[model samples]
Target chain A: MTVTLIGGEMLHWSDRPATPALPPVGEITGRTLVAGPHPHDLIASLPAERTTVLLRGLPDAEAVAGLGVTVWAGSLDKVAATPAFDTIVALDGLDRLCSAEAETLDGWDERLAHLLTLLRPGGRLLLRVENLFGVHRLIALPEALGDSEWLVADDRDPHRPAGLAALRERLAVVREYAAYGDALLSREVLADAELSGFVSATIAGALATTGEVLADPAALATRALRHGLALELAPAWVVVTGGAADTPDAVVGAKAVAAADPPRGRTLEDELIAAAQRRDLPAMRALLTAWQKSPAAGVPAAQVIAGSASPAASDLTPLAPAGDPLVALSHFAAAAIRGDIAHLWPAPADEAELTALIAGMTGREVEPADVPPLPSRPAPGAVRELTAERDRLARELAEARAKHEFYEQQIRGRDAELKRVRQINAVLSATAPGKAVLGGLKAGRRAVRAVVKRGRA
Target chain B: MECGVHHANHYYGHSAVLARYCGLDDEAPRIQGYLQHGWNIGDGLAPDHEFVPGVPKFLWSERVRRRAWSLGRRDVYVVGAPWAYLLALEPAAPAEREGTIWYPFHGWEGQHVLGSHDNLIAEIKATEPGPVTVCLYWQEYRDKAVRATYEKAGFRVICHGYRGGWWKDLDPGFLYRQLAELRRHSRVASNRLCSAVFYGTLAGCAPAVYGDPMQLENEKSAFGGQARILREWSDMIGAEVDLETARRVAVAELGADRLLPPAELRRLFGWPAPRSTAAIELTGVLTS
Candidate 1:
């Protein structure tokens, strides 16, 4: 079986004595032809086999000794080899070509067609392309408001992906379709630093697309894009496999489900804060449900996020678990635990039922006030910004204090050294020889000043 | 198990992350498709003396299995990574669950997978009804810098280690113990699709993948080497993963045959074959 690897530099940054993770490419025993950067890895994988990897650049003679695989310094841009292989691993080769071709989708279809020509009737093309619309496009934008907040909905950068919409249109002729990407990692800007731009050169930013989000965001973004939403995002590279002849069947995990249940909560801290400011009960309730893990988790998110209650937290009480038997029981148990039964269950209920439910819930007797305290709505931008400013000041103050301490130590050392020098000079002056030398220097300085005054007169 | 350049031994951890949801053993026979060169273990490579010769062989892809054949070994089984097993495993209903757990992917230089800059501890704490538990890399459990980074963002931090200096070297199953800790949180968000993403999603937590992850392209091999070798693996990363499309796909695929059918599984694994005690210990028994 022949395995043809196609891409830019599969081994460009690969270790010399490759790590076990980068297995030797010598496993393709029959006649093989490789394209792009897997020369070293292929050499490591081979054992006296008829294997050849194409190179677009000059071959280093020292690197290509009698190691079994032949290095052909030839271009695979056209994929001109005869069709004989059973497997073709095109690892981001299309994406690389598109990049080198400067993001125009032109000539890419021809390149893909050539690749297809090289594939045998039942062979697989393990193709990888970057996502055009990923969350990075959303989050990695330059932050506004002094580079503090993410421009999540305000991205305007031109993305030049050979988009999947175009690719899917072209791939319609191919058999089998499995699309996935490698940008599973997520990105949140560190509170202090703006994110480096997505796919940009600098690595200092807190959340970078290639650095963090490991899975492709293309499928997700495609859903939104199909719905006519702008700002859909993609991953750096999406690797898909299509067959040449066989029809594509439902691979495991390829099936789609009904729309996801609404998120238990708003996970982004900023979004939750915005929802809280609007007093959007449904949003708050969902966020609260998800945030129910920590009593502590909810309060700080509430404190930092603020707004005038448009609907008011009071309006959202119906969504609360007031009707829940367990909730009722828990409330009674909480009140009982707190020894405050004057207020129970918001309204009147059967006392005996409450007691029984509480007993069942607590395994003995039951906990909380009938209604949770509504968080004090901070006056406009009171709580969060103040907290942020205070924290920033605290950090600066700590740094300043550290610097102050360091300077104080330096001053004290200098003062001690100065005193020691004075004492040494005094001791020197106290000696007869030292005093005579000092007096002579002083007299000489006085004579020089007198001579200068006489010459000026 | 999974393998990759994502971390010290990503395959080892990602495979072991299965234990985070279902109580499974490390030797339960997994294909480390997550490794970059997963399909190309050479013939001249060293044979592991520590690993017992198999009754049920675990492999990640058909290519890897073929490579094994080239090496004169044939007890090969093609099963994808652990997260794919989520479709086959029992369902976890996160809505019915309570509480949020935060998993911050810790990198080599006190970096995190999601690039989290929020003070997770304080944020979780401020949620009056919610409690947050911090998940760290096994190595990050010791790095004060990584922990301190979280603390700097507004959290009063605590590593997954002991309360103080007392529990540094203490663990019953240190190699695969994060799952037990992970079971407590109903929701989790991390920077990378590492253990937290795999286990958190399966264990019925509302999981979010966000943050800057390092060396991602190197781990692409975990997606499997052949066409459709892994199902819905594409669904689980990026914004799609953020939207829980993976979870949705997993649920739809869980119709007793979402993953390869049991007959196929049995044919491939022969999981219930009689084995010597040593073999049983080296490899784990697949439960029905």
Candidate 2:
């Protein structure tokens, strides 16, 4: 294997530092041109003789060449105009394939078309497109410009696929998988129509491992699944151009590549929230009764599968029971609040009160200890946490100011009352009847004092 | 448990009623939340009264709870009014209840009502078909001149005792006496749409709110004062209200249906459960 330099490639910069989740290496077959930078291990796994890795960075190209695969180091436009490769793998999407050193193709549509043209007749194209309206972006705080955002056309590009459905239509996709996790590290991939209880539990589990997010990604992801918009709200999408293959419906974790079993029914949390949104008290009570009576009562409702008559914890691994059963119920309660589900209470209830009410439905009264320690939860993100704190402080400040003003008014009112009472006393002393009463009161006090003195003597 | 913190919780012996409803008998527990003391157009709280942040506000109804939430209160719960709890504790005996019990809007310390009490008395005489008994706040009842005005109008005048001050002389029987007096009357009427009207409606009395709504000195319209009350509650403001509609509005405004069971109320108030029930709950917990 030789590293060929076609000039115009970046000498220092690599596309992504972390390894991205890719299609199963078993799927990358025939003479393949791996577009953009991929992990070294993934390049080594591919058939070296047939694989031709194209990288925009010289250092990345050299590293791939060391893995016993042909490496073409240059901008994507410099690659031969002839359609040669039987497969084109641009799992990083078409954005990073172009280099600033060469003719920069900023339009997503133009870059995508170029990648498609590079593929030979009867070839396959594996692509990954980041979703603009994804859950990750929805909860993301405003970020400063990064090196990768040199040409921000994704937001303005009309032809660029915006969602899973649009992407399928745009690419004529044979198979599509909803990808969840950080963009570079797609943790879980599931088929578009396979958001079953098992798939959701898997999605939630995968999302929990997300490092720093504005809000709980797990809650938002599960809500998306419950609302039947998981495919649209997925953080990213992986699409393949060609006829469908017999690949697994769900691929969990990029490295291990374990095919998850077929999906089960809806999660307990999902069903309970749906019932709550509809204000179906009887259904909610029944679901709460069933869950509380089950062996998985101590498990978080989001992690349990709501079977017909019973609930089973999705993760079979023996985990420590959430100490208070109310704590277990609070998981779904918090999710419901975060999901903006209509409150079930006839009156407005916060998360703690709602959890207590849920416990009450199961004949349990929640003590102060039973309330979930929600504030101690991993801070959603620095921005949101700070924003909430600032809002709280602002409210407290406004309250304190109001209290100060109230106290001042109270003092003023008291002063006015005292002055009014003094004026009334002055007016009373000026009257004949008032003088007689005052004289009698003075005489009575003198008589009492003399009697007390006589008794002491 | 002793009632302290924001002594208004003990106003009209409100905490005592809630405590009794929670099975505390005569012992008034320190309510874990700020119990809404009076019905107001504001967020269930007296705008002049300061609140501690994060402390729960136990309100009377869903409407007030929503209003309180809009006012930036997050930890608000609807526990119904103390008067409702009192009625639950003391079911009225069947008796020949006669006359209309009238409540004239009154002012508290540092404020005096500025309207014609004689005019209100005349309105009451004209509207009420039967005998009328006017219930006055302690301050007005203490004034012989004010008392004689209502008495001169041929209406029986009475006062429901002092509503306590600071931590001093909190009469636990305040609501009990008010409820008893209300139940003895066939109808309840008020010059303004006040808490007494709602309480009386819930206590099986036909309710009416009309005539001069006396204004307080320096009355602030911070929460859309009397105008908002008249606009929002126009159905309740008539010389003769439909009994069914009055009762329905009373139930919603007072949250009669939102009353908690004794055990749950105890938990919410952070009061200890009675030993027997505690042991039963403990057994249930361990068995489960």
Candidate 3:
């Protein structure tokens, strides 16, 4: 197998001590060729039997002599000429060269189209392009806010004390400059300039086109001229190549070209905004439900809807619990939508419940059929009257029981006392003699008393 | 005899104040007037420990003596946790002394799992002198090892029912007052009793061997008292001894005189008595 790396650091495989050794390829082993502004050591690690080459700066005819190893370099009109190479990695070189080589390069999409022409039928071409809906752009403007020259100059001022007033002045200057500059530049011109530059830098270490320049074409001439001048001021490396004659079957199979290069249709954000503006619950629900299943779909949509001042944001709150992809995505979407606006923000407790619900939602999205109907309200005065009557009855019963227990205890105590008193009376009466018996006893006692007295005297 | 009577009266009065402070109003009167005054109206039983139906004296005098000798005066060193009465006495008495150490052995409820025991051990070592005696009312014998450890560390262990015997004679008011004061005196005392009785008991304070059984035994032994306990307070109004006994017990046991000395009583209870000569002279000098 032969691998070709272009417009990058050399592929010095041998330098990587940690890189695992590749298995032997066929009888001759595999060879690799790297072409870039700087030569790297990765090419040296290839088996001795396998041929290896390093092409740096611009490849000259003498350097390509006798090696049969294809030579490839960055060019606009010469892709067809590089038929000997195994692969071509061109980025907007054609559109850039076709448009009188603007001060800045333009047409990354056209350049990619041109590169495809150079590739052999069934050859692999991997293109890494910036995502149009990437967070980079939104954050990029604010990043540029600090990059204003006035802000830099203010920061450099030695006399100014490091204080909030100075910082505020610098910020104000940056804001003014950005607002004026951004207003002057058309959207198409800015998008094209950004996209062109990004593509060029990725492929040839030069800013060729940008999304901002592509989005606005009216301002394109100025941005293009400025970029062209910059490119003339500083040249960068670019390369292109053709697939080898003996390319592997697997590489051919994996290298299926995209069917169409249509401009990214309404971004997820735009769809969300449109849905929210119309208050189309079904569409909003569909979009959110789709996002819940696949968080990637939800993030952009959430950002767009949350950016606007519509009640749709409130509708999206319920979507937090729809755990399709791991609930993390829903929470992230909710937070991004809510942002920092307190009035617009969901209740924290509700949000917390949403978080837990989202966690529970993980692995599945809530289908419309799953939601239950709302509960019916209870009758108003019935409950109040019932409770009141119950309390009254309970109190009355308790009082009655207490009275009964008191009376019962009193009766028992009195009965025991009466029984004891009766016993005591009987004992006393049994021990006492009658009065008549006492009188009869007194007469007998008198006679005996006289006899006893005479005896005693 | 007059002076002794006067001293006794003063102590009783102070005890009443202490009981009042302790919230043992029932016990306060009994100890203050009845017990201290030795006023036996025949109906006067030993608060709750009534000997017979009418005999208001010690049930088993021999037992009291034996128990007292075994548990009392011989350097009883309470080392578990600080009680209010103990903390109050801590400043007055020598930290190291020989006397009956009466620690309301509530057990390790107050001890922190981390370093509480170690801290207690350190305090005991620092404060106590002579053979340490601990009165354990907790039922768990599994703590025999812990008690044995204390014994090994020169402490003598004495096991008794945590809540029984003379404890029943104690006025709840007095207990509350003493406990509250102890809580105020030392955080350790608050934690000990609170944790032991409240938490540990619920958590099962070392399988009480004698608690329910002892209560049943007491009820069976005192037939009339048992009846009194069963009868409602309203019904027991005519019955001689009722909740009054429990109340009186709380007062007597929790009274200020039982808790503090004459001098401390005068200072703390605000009692009227002959001022000390020094105090009088000092007052006169200040006035002059």
What candidate 2 gets wrong by more than 4 Å, as runs, is: A1-171, A181-205, A213-233, A244-324, A330-382, A386-457, B1-4, B47-57, B65-78, B88-99, B104-159, B210-229, B257-288
Per-model CA lDDT versus the true structure: 0.37, 0.71, 0.29
Error of 1 at A276 (Å): 4.2
Question: Candidate 1 at B205: error in angstroms?
Answer: 45
Candidate 1 global CA lDDT score:
0.37
Model 2, A113-208: lDDT tens digits are 877788876678888788888887887767678886777746667888777667767777776767775222222343433335666776776664
**Candidate that would win on lDDT:** 2
List, in order, the clash count of every candidate structure: 71, 0, 81
Candidate 1 error regions (>4 Å): A1-73, A78-80, A95-106, A131-162, A173-232, A236-457, B1-288
Candidate 2, A44: how far from true, in Å? 17
What tens digits encode model 2's per-residue C-alpha lDDT throughout B148-200? 99998888999999999775788888888888888889999998899999999
lDDT of 3 by residue, B1-288 (tens): 000011222221324433333323333233211122221212222333211111112111122222323542111111111122322322332232232232433323233222233345445555444344544445433476656655666655554333222223322232333333223221111112212222111111111111111122112332244234334222212212233343332222222112222222222222233323222111000000
Ranked candidates (TM-score, high to low): 2, 1, 3
Model 1, range A260-357, lDDT digits (tens) per residue? Answer: 21112211233433453452323533443333222222232311122123222221111122233334333332323222231221111123333332
* Interface RMSD in angstroms for candidate 1: 27.1
TM-score of each: 0.25, 0.59, 0.19
Best by DockQ: 2
Stretches of model 3 off by over 4 angstroms after superposition: A1-39, A42-74, A88-105, A131-457, B1-193, B197-204, B207-288
lDDT of 3 by residue, A28-145 (tens): 2233322221112223333333333433223331233234444443333333344432332211112212222122223444444554554555443322222222222221223354
Each candidate's B-chain TM-score, in sequence, is 0.45, 0.92, 0.25
